[model samples]
Target: MPFVIILVVLTVPAAIFFCWYQMLVRKYKNSSFIMVYHKVDRYRGGLKGLCVSPEAFDRQMDYLYRRGYRAIPLGSLVDSIINKKDILPKTFVLTFDDGYENNYVNVLPVLKKYGWTATVFLNAGAIGQTVQYPMQPPEKHLTAEQIKEMSGRFDFEPHGITHRALTGLSDDEIREEAEGSKKVVEQLTGKDADIFCYPFGEYNGRVINLLKEAGYRASCTTLPGIVRQDADAYQLPRFEFKETKVWSPRYFFRNFDFYLRTFFAI
Candidate 1:
């Protein structure tokens, strides 16, 4: 039995090769891939450090251009996942959470250069509200007017009323967080927000249902994974792009196993 187990382990590589050969004999199959981004800025004070830098962001977009990755809007992504439509190999969606002013100042130009459109999730309460908690700083929040102007160029969605964590809140609180932002955005932009991005990517079944009740077509989680046909649209997963772009190669070329852990069973 010990020798048999050892032989099985030795034969595993051959088994994988056989399977690879069979796949070559059969038609190759590819799945849809989606990538998510948060902020794009220099590594410094506050939460801006977590976002991708201007140079790195440019490089990433350039790489995609050279590689033939076509950009898609968040709405199209929701439709594709919900309808189980085939996404091209060179297709992806660019999204940003928190609606930081840098998105307008820095990231917008880069995206414009590539003719790419990204989805920005705004916290209605924080739209023009100043941050008085940790530090006193003034950052523009893509004002209602700016949001409207940017409409034809990008998709503006809802994050929450105040970017509060919903995982520890009650059902009503969760509903308020989800529904309130949707209403605020709809009123501000005169366009209904169909997508919701969970603040800090924290949510559970209650939060999910509350988002649905709030009329959100889909919501994104910070969990890293690929969008598959069998995956849940409400808890869709995403990978955070860093300021350094050190892992862009591996991240952009993620495989099925990575998606399995990041998207499903979350």
Candidate 2:
């Protein structure tokens, strides 16, 4: 426990340095960020990247709350981009990839408790299938009705129909992966979603163009960085919050300036 505690503590300064390097030293000085999550579960198998454990999750939320950060919905972010408006200070967007039912079972309550909003990227074909990554056991994806209900709190965007690797697919296949997802979500919810997430952050210029043709306002990747005004709306970078030993509330706060720098720094 102490080791975990220390690891978390040590990451604070490193995160600070990273912020300075990216935000202050970099040339692009517009600061915006989007945080990514996949699953929020208990720490198991010394897996340090799941963003697991309720206690750690609570601490992270508390840090955000105390910082007076607003957890804006992803749709609002899209609107901000189109309108070319400034995101308020300490503004952040929370997004969860893969519509894990646990998000409905677990993460939803936490967000509700904190009065936070997030976006859930769902894979249409995988709604009731076994998980492939990090080896989470089979679980139902959020049901259509369930998703509709949750959409009231969080935006439900498309990851894809089948969580396939986009880089491996043909142009037509890519369109199915990209355009098809938009259609699916729209048919189900009767609402048009302009937000998308690449499965595994796999993309190319063609994929980006396909996303635009599909009418997505923006898309998220697995790349680790923050969003800035000049940053490409599509292929926007996100920091994945893995359940690592190097996680702590202080570490998160110390990295705020770093994230700001990464997004805004020149």
Candidate 3:
């Protein structure tokens, strides 16, 4: 009788978990993922370092490629969503924020192999500079030559004039960050710089208005959600790929609940 009771207790929970896993799979079946990445460099400070190893990135890209996933630029995805155009199946976007030097050295090679283009959001004021973080090694931003070289493959976009919290700035300062960045990045890419990513994913109404005035059509936020045609253009959500976790199938299955909550924002 005790054995029968133990079997019932274990099997019931296992069956319930299986059902929930199947449901999450069905819910986000058609959803598009806009993956956010920072430095594609050596790891430090663990996952909080916001760094994904190049080897892990290679594996993730290979997995996606094998699954028939196609990569697209952020602006193109936003335009289609805003204009109510049909979105292709199994499409994803790759965005690198903070314009790290490692992105050029590490990420670009993997992208070239896949014939993919990504968006790089640069802090216009911090060009050719190294940014220091507390208790971690200093990270370098992309240099002008690197930007120019990758401009054809990377859609260089404005992050800000300085990597400051836009919500804390005055209206004029916000405008400067927005308009000033647009001007410089357009010069670098020789194309329309219409997309903006908020510094540290921080923004307010003033920042949005200034971005619109600066001719920006869309912006990215660090919010967690899947992209749909009805998603807000100015407040797009993304999931950052960091080395804190290896993005293997076992990791995902084991942490499916955590991902489901963060990804779907439930």
Candidate 4:
């Protein structure tokens, strides 16, 4: 009985560990990780998880740089997948949601420091608007001028005009939101607004069709996972980089391990 009990304890943990290791391997191998960030600020209010401090952002970028991860634009990733090219090792795409002024102020410098660029999804109605979400005060979001200034380092895309959930709107309304925002972004940036990010990550078949009609080549969702070659272009998943545990090396690894284990079940 004693021998049997010891064997069971050892075997159980060993089996679990082996399974977890396999999951990690599967999760990272031949996959491109897309990380989504919202506000890069020192603000303590609102959804704290959505706000990553500039210092933390710098450290995270430094970590990626030290680890030899290559930051690629989302458009390049889409083209590669469409062309059936193998995703390079340690390739990652950085995305920022919400056209917050802080993103230009805090996030841009860090990215520029590393000579990297990211995709920013802009809420068409919020741009140049004084107020921001969670009832923040004016000048919260990026202005048209600010966006143009940062065009060299950021690829701006539409995040819906009013940031409404596309799934809840009627077909015509969805088309207006999707197509209108795309046009607005293109007008402001003088570049094709080829990508869309579903506001609140809420989408459906009709919404997807609307985005396609609007000339969007791809869209991003809040769904958590590494982007595989076979993944849907409109429903691409992203890893939300929360500020809570991302700063701690131990906690970050622990959370990452948990994410891999949870998403890639054996």
Between candidates 1 and 3, name the one with more favorable TM-score: 3
Q: Which residue window of length 10 is worst by lDDT in model 1?
A: 257-266
- Give candidate 1 regions above 4 Å deviation: 1-30, 47-49, 132-138, 244-266
lDDT for 145 in candidate 4 is 91
Pairing residues by index, what is the TM-score of model 2?
0.79
Alpha-carbon runs more than 4 Å astray in model 3: 1-30, 44-48, 133-136, 245-266
In model 3, residue pairs whose N, Cα or C atoms come closer than 3 Å (at least 3 residues apart or on different chains), thus clashing, are: none
lDDT of 2 by residue, 1-266 (tens): 99999998999889998986765644434356788887677544433565466666777777777766668877666666667776455667888888877777778888899888888998977765555554544555778777877876788889998888888888899888888888888888788878889987889888888878878888888876666666678877876665563457655664554444434323
Which 10 consecutive residues of model 2 have the lowest summed lDDT? 257-266
lDDT of 1 at 222: 82
Q: Higher lDDT: candidate 3 or 4?
A: 4
Among the numbered candidates, top TM-score falls to 4
Q: Which segments of candidate 4 are over 4 A away from where they belong?
A: 1-27, 135-139, 245-266
Q: Where is model 2 more than 4 Å wrong at Cα?
A: 1-30, 43-48, 129-136, 245-266
Q: What is candidate 3's lDDT per residue for 1-266, written digit by digit as tens?
A: 99999999999999998998778766655456688888787776534548778998898788777767778988778878889886666788999988889999999999999999899999888778898745557788899999999877888899888788999999888888899999998887788999999988998887888888879899999875678777879988886655665477754664453356344432
> Mind giving the per-residue lDDT tens digits that candidate 4 earns over 9-99?
9999999999878877776666687889988889657667787889988987887777677688899888877777777777789999988
Query: How many clashes in each candidate?
Result: 0, 15, 0, 2
lDDT of 4: 0.83
Q: Rate the local accuracy (lDDT) of all candidates.
A: 0.72, 0.74, 0.81, 0.83
Error of 4 at 244 (Å): 2.7
lDDT of 1 by residue, 1-266 (tens): 99999999989989998886666423222344456665566655565536577788888778777766667787887887788886545466788877777787787788788888888989788786544324324455666666776776688889998778998998988888888888888888788797999887888888888888889889888887666655688988776665554446765454444433233312
